[model samples]
Target chain A: MSRLSRFLKDNGISVVFGVGFLLSLIGQAFAGRAEFNEELQSDGARPVGFFEYVATSHFAVDITENWQSEYLQFFLFLFGTVWLLQRGSPESKEMHKAGLESDKDQRVGPHAREDSPRWAAVGGLRQTLYSRSLGIVMLTAFLGSWLAQSISGAAALSEERLRGLQEPVPWASYLLSADFWSRTLQNWQSELLAVGSMAIFAVYLRQRGSPESKPVGASHDATGIEG
Target chain B: MRTIARLAVLTLVVGVPLTGCAVPQDRLEAVRKATERFATLHTAGDFRAACALLTSAAREEAVHNGGPTCAQALADAELPEPGAIRSTDVYGRQARVELATDTYFLTSFPGGWRISAAGCTPREGRPYRCLLKGD
Candidate 1:
């Protein structure tokens, strides 16, 4: 394959998602600006420019809220699947393979293959950290995004309060307020529902080539089977 | 992958505070001065001067609320003394200056900060009921 074709094949998933993210973000900006301007007009305020709208807490909160929820969903899935078993679901490990398996099964330390990661090969705090790195990373992303959402949401809500000639609460107060929890829980509930449904659906569903689903010919009772 | 993750974490850490509750010192000072100027003009009974320092919407609303002109309406309203500025909270173009006796709301235009409301009293779980609120 040509270099371009090779690069495309190698990085197709990332590229596709990245492009989709950009397009969706751009579309959101335009739509949000229009909606914002309409409100501004009704409120006797001047319409903001596209760039200015993008920089506002309104846009920041909306983006970060969604991001935090997605990361939270992934974080829960990553950690939960390690301990919780969903029988016959392609998304889960085999029924007998619950909990952290043996060192031999994991191929760490003495059992580490040459191709294994350096941290995995070594036995120490590094190995312990590397063992749970995926969960750690997901948790970190979720926390970071959630914090971002809170900060930006507070700012946005404060502006609205100010517009209404009300007292703008401090960031700390906002974090503790119902507005913050409402925004967080609303997104979180939807994300959790999607994840739970996906897990349950995969038990009976089949996708011909997708690794997320069991093979078309795979038995419904076959656990941990992926295409 | 590690580098990307680190960058994302760093961005979130830094971007949150930068994007959140950032009112520039200079802008705050400017808003403070504008509030002081409005108070001075209004307290001195120079209603025209005070009216001049109001947002166009506010001026229109002031006129519509009371007398035929903005100044006439403001003079008729008999706004109370604002006293010293206790605190100020600014969010984007809108700012609230809390005085010893009352609160005033200001909005920034291309020229400078203009009074949007004054002699504002808080209503529970609602927008402040301002004596001279903008439309």
Candidate 2:
């Protein structure tokens, strides 16, 4: 295989998901544009084209709201596993290994192996930062997306209000509105439920070939064991 | 982490709404001009000219197919005396122009802005009560 082919083969799952994301986003833009135009027509406004709809806050809010929740789910999962444990699930560390493990166990600082990342072998802030980079990045993405949602959300709402000949609410005031919390919590609840259910389900369930599950024949009480 | 998160949110909160809205100045001026013309024509008792400035839906509301013609209906409805145009706010393809005595709601068409509602007065928290409206 060529170098590019080797790289694609090495990251097959990410490549597939990346392609899927693009396809779904394009699909969303088309569907969203149609729906948006229908709404505009009802309001006695002119129908916007596809490109115009894509630039609208209605589209931005829809995209960012989902992105924020997904990022929050991953951020919580990554950060939670350090201190929280589910004894019989591969999704968690062993009960005895709960909380940030010893530096030696984590192979950080003086205990890092020769091939370990340079930051992992260093001490001080760099080591601390590299250690929690995944969770930090995920959390940051969640906050940024949520903020974007709020900005676009305020604009979209204002557009609706304008259609009705009502004055637009200020962005600061919109943050306190029921609509803001409603959108945020609606997505958060579903994600939290899914992760919570998965954690508990993996305690007893088994999948033979998947790394996300323990060996089918492994003891049901086994923890932190992959197929 | 907290600082970064707060900064990201703060940047967007203060920045996006202010900078994101880029309504074309020409479109806004067009809306304002259309609103003033509707008011001007109505004030001059040029109901035929005024009827031309109304949206198709608003014209229908005025005539209702079974009613008198649009110009005749406007001559009889006794809509408020439209005062001088004050301000025009255009959001997307819709606009609301505040006049000295009334509010006019308009929608942008290929031809230009056309009044969908005219001689509208505030009704507390409810939608404006207009002498003429589309829906």
Q: Can you write out model 1's per-residue Cα lDDT over A165-197, one digit (the tens) per residue? A: 888878899889998999899999999899999
Cα lDDT of model 2 by residue, A1-227, tens digit: 89999999998997899789889989999999999889877876678888877777788788888888999999999999988988889998887998888999999988999999999999999999999998987897888778878877877887787678676656798899887889999999999999999988888887779999889988888999988
Task: Evaluate residue B46 in candidate 1 and report its C-alpha lDDT on the 0 to 100 scale.
Answer: 95
Report RMSD (Å) for each prediction in the order shown.
1.8, 4.7
TM-score for each of the candidates: 0.94, 0.82
User: Best by DockQ, which number?
Assistant: 1
Q: State iRMS for model 1.
A: 1.4
Provide i-RMS per model in Å.
1.4, 4.0
Q: Pick the candidate with the highest TM-score.
A: 1
Best by lDDT: 1
lDDT of 1 by residue, B23-120 (tens): 78999999999999999999999999999999988899988889799899999987889999999888877899999988999988889999999999
Lowest summed lDDT over 10 consecutive residues: which window, candidate 2 chain B?
B11-20
